[model samples]
Target: MENIQCFRPTKAVIDLQAIRDNVVHLKNMLQPEVQIIAVVKANAYGHGDIEVARTAMEAGATILAVATPDEAVHMREYFPQVGILVLGATPISFVPYAAANDIMLAVFSQEWVEQAAKQNIDRSLKLHIKIDTGMGRIGVSTRDELQQLYDAITAASHMLVDGVFTHFATADEEDTKYFDKQVKMFKDFLQLLPKKPRLVHVANTATSLIKDASLQFDAVRYGISMYGLAPSPYVETILPFPLRPAFSLQTELVYVKKIKAGQSVGYGATYTAEEDCYVGTLPIGYADGMIRKLCGQNVLVDGKFAPIIGRICMDQCMILLPTAYNIGEKVTLIGTQQGVTISIDDWAGKLETINYEVPCIITNRVPRIYSN
Candidate 1:
């Protein structure tokens, strides 16, 4: 049978079921009047953008948000019926392509608004004006700036100003003063504009969880949470909902050995066997986006934990497996099955990274297998 197939050192398994659940769950966290814009940028944080985007829309998302124009175009091409907004800036020269493809653009500058008006393209263009209340990044800084751009935008009937939004610099921080200030700034800017926007959004994943009912705008951008992850450190401590992690990484044992005392293992000869012990080699390593820092980490096998014993090489690594598990048996690197567990959060902590980067770190060379 194909039970004994080629085994790789590292693999990332995605749970689309959890993704679907998270989308619906996140949407429910907001009010009925609020809409959800699922942030699918960075390839849905490496959970496969095309797959996650389709799931997100079906689950509860009204619009799919991307960080760049290219990602927006990619999503638009793959899912023609879906609405896409390029949350980041698109060059003036690329306007025709964006309009022809019906991609929404984020306009923060008068220069870009003027360009969109001058382009005078036949197709309709959706624009979401960004505000720089406290993010210290791109967007309109003051109400005066927004009024000028809004006036120019409305003058051009060809362009449609669909929404006005801002980014929160510290929504996830312990202090909510900065985020509170941004809320006021966005509201004040809205009053200055002559036309009322169809949608007003500012909350990202972090702000989406806040208790401030007034902070709730017309919509919110759901990012890391859509992949069953929190946007920041305080989410679990702050939010009412418990976020479930949706990814598990695993591989199989390829070789086994009994190393005598004083035997050194792997590169740099750093690990020395202290006693007569069994060792195992796995097919995963840094090349597969398995961080080498987890060399001393533990993986689960045969309902017991095996400590990884030495420097992690590029294509292979060593694990101290028990005498019970045989070849072709499953290895649990980041999962809980058969009364064993090796959490992805634990793995991320060892690598000195966040849970968000853990998914992104898994290389595309490893195929993602989905589970219920």
Candidate 2:
């Protein structure tokens, strides 16, 4: 669907129904008692957070998870009553605001808990104890640390231990040795808690989809897969259910002209036409997150693949067309055109990055149009 307000030809189209379907499918695969914590961080992985969160909730997601307190607050504005969890560390100053807004925060250290307890807040602050089984990012590393933090939070009248969780370092990998170790460590941390919190989530999207059903404790943080993307190729090969991708980038050729042999194109004049072939200029470039590294990438044009040629400009780029194509012809940068498909994975492969970074890096300048 196109946005009437967007005058630019380049836009990112989002399929909200695909987001809904992904959540619904994940819900079906999980245990009946397990809750789906839809990870809508990074603006729902650049698909637009509020819209995806709504669709996920409608499809039975019970909670929303974000990477920062600001994101949680942003989500709270749109969803007044929906549960929001900050999956990352929070500033000591944000405690009062989080408590007042009923946003849950991930806590790791006893020092953080002590500092947060000092904040003069009237409402109870909900917290999820992050146990660092092996991620080496955040969370308490040992059972002793976990116990101290748990005790500190319990001692605070205005603080509540809402949940306890950990992140797996290699749930998406073929080798399960480290993954199994993380799982065991997380379980060990849980045992240290005098009583398990209401939520004991430990599985991320990869673990939830491919690991044992027992890992889906109370909830699973559904991130990349919720946007209809596999966490990795290993997980993709063994997915229990197919994911319907929600993001598609598109534009149109504003200028099409035949370049003579030996004629150069774009900045630095890197690409020169070896033969008399038509070169089409698209109204999308590095500024729109079609980075310079993607100059050699293929984009779908009228059911055929056209390679982007020359140095990508800030707001424009040239594609070496197979033949003479008229101006205003539709171009798909990351989507299906006719029967041909150009996926985010294609861009990832070209950029030598992961699929998660493809959509997230697409600048906000490119408006996202939503479709059911």
Candidate 3:
């Protein structure tokens, strides 16, 4: 077996410039006073968090947002002064950790405030209230619940309301019925608040890009779009500016051979050659987040397209090549080669998923290389 960690050229190359441009584009599109909170969650959506966070902040983002307490903690190492907001719930037990690190937690219930107040920690915690304006997730759904939660937080000397936000379920879709309903509910929730928080945010990447400008509150959580990815296929068409994808997957051919006509390749003998053909083996497969279902997808080699011929293996996969190639020839699995390009959208379409899942699934084994 080959050494998996040494000399393997498989990498997820990230372009910092694309991220900076995207953030600046979003900043320019928003009102002068509206702030851009770069959503650096999910390891910056699998493009590497610390790198993306620094680049985004340098490009004008004033805040950083993540999905969990651990993520918030990890971000604190690199960004000591910038605001870090946990979009997901932080258990009361971990509340002290967040408060100490100056990280804000999203509270959706009055019970959360009650528990946080019980903690003896001396530091005050900045918090955001998530109103369930229609994501149907962790948020207060009714006016009474909102009022109670607001009062509870305000009552606690250790807790301070810094922001209030909601997520939209259909902001990326073409239809406006559900999207408008969410906006209305968010407005109604705001009406019930005794006094508004310093930051009132509900616009996500999709909402900020395609929805009404009034929805762009004090700040917008720029998530997928900050990484230069369209929120959905529909949003791609209406995007205010062109988005340059910041991610690409690359590798190199490790082995090559010519198979005779009628020969089968890969496990289970699922691929049989109709004629003598060149087959190239790559040092990447399912364990690297290439998942088995993508067995028949196309990969770019030498500026041309090659079909993946059989079941992708745990450590290797076979691609039909036009001709015999050197063992170290470059291969493009998810990027531009010559004039052709393979995009995450292409992979998502074949897998029946979304662009977000495409990069998120590309396991950590593949090293991430950054570029300007």
TM-score, every prediction = 0.90, 0.98, 0.97
TM-score of 3: 0.97
lDDT tens per residue, model 2, 1-372: 335488989999999999989999999999988999999999999999888898899999999999998899899999999999999989999999999999999999899999999999999999999989889999889778888999999999799999999999999999999999998888877877788799999899999999999999999999999998999999999999999999999999999999899999989999988889999999998888999999899998889999999999999999999988888899999989898999999999999999999999999999999999
Task: In candidate 3, list every pair of residues with a backbone clash.
Answer: none
Pairs clashing within candidate 2 = none
Q: Alpha carbon lDDT of residue 248, candidate 1?
A: 82
RMSD of 1: 3.1
Q: Give stretches of model 3 more than 4 Å off.
A: 1-6
Question: For model 1, which pairs clash?
Answer: 9-283, 9-284, 10-284
lDDT of 3 by residue, 16-51 (tens): 999999999988888979999999899999999999
Q: What lDDT would each prediction earn against the true structure?
A: 0.79, 0.92, 0.90
Give candidate 1's TM-score.
Answer: 0.90
Q: Indicate which candidate wins on TM-score.
A: 2
Distance from true location, Cα of 268 in model 3, Å: 1.1
Q: What is the C-alpha RMSD of each candidate to the true structure, in Å?
A: 3.1, 1.2, 2.8
Per-residue lDDT over 290-363 for candidate 1, one digit per residue giving the tens place of the 0 to 100 score: 77888889988876888998999887889876674567667878887687777767877898877788778878
Sort all candidates by TM-score, best to worst: 2, 3, 1
